[model samples]
Target: MVQYTPRWVGKQEESIHIAHIASVKIDTNLLLSNVLIETTGGANPIRCHGHHKADAVRMKALIERYQNDYYRGGGAPVGSAESTPAGR
Candidate 1:
């Protein structure tokens, strides 16, 4: 199951975030680490020598890592379009 938060933006209701946790396989022998992992979206399946079930703590850490990368990684600037004018 995934965890999500809801917030109110003006008069509209919105979801703040959605966090998901699942078991992932890591094949050290694989040339591409990402291929060794699996996600929900439509992606190419990869070989899995073994899998490790992630616990709550590990899931939390992974969520944090994902958030950090999405928000602060070496890519487009965060809040690029969310900023609002002082009077608006």
Candidate 2:
């Protein structure tokens, strides 16, 4: 015996697809903190063997590139917590 399933005639048309883009909040303190933690020479981790100033400059550049990409790709607002609001 075969079970019959109702065919969907473009049923997904009514559904809304909301995209979530993770935005990076660039803070010097936080960047440096992460670099330090990762670079500590105890175990194998993402290590940065450079001066703080240099590392900061590099990270800042990276952050700017990411922000540009986000803006270009029509990313969601800079600080929206929920995936989607009830109404829209």
Measured by lDDT, the strongest candidate is 1
Tens digit per residue, CA lDDT, model 1, 11-68? 4332223222223444433332321333455354333333233333354456456656
TM-score of each model, in listed order? 0.25, 0.28
| lDDT values, one for every candidate | 0.38, 0.37
Clashing pairs in 1: none
Candidate 2: regions farther than 4 A off: 1-51, 76-88
TM-score of predicted structure 2: 0.28
Question: Cα-based RMSD of the predictions, in order?
Answer: 14.3, 18.3
User: Candidate 1, residue 71: CA error in Å?
Assistant: 1.2
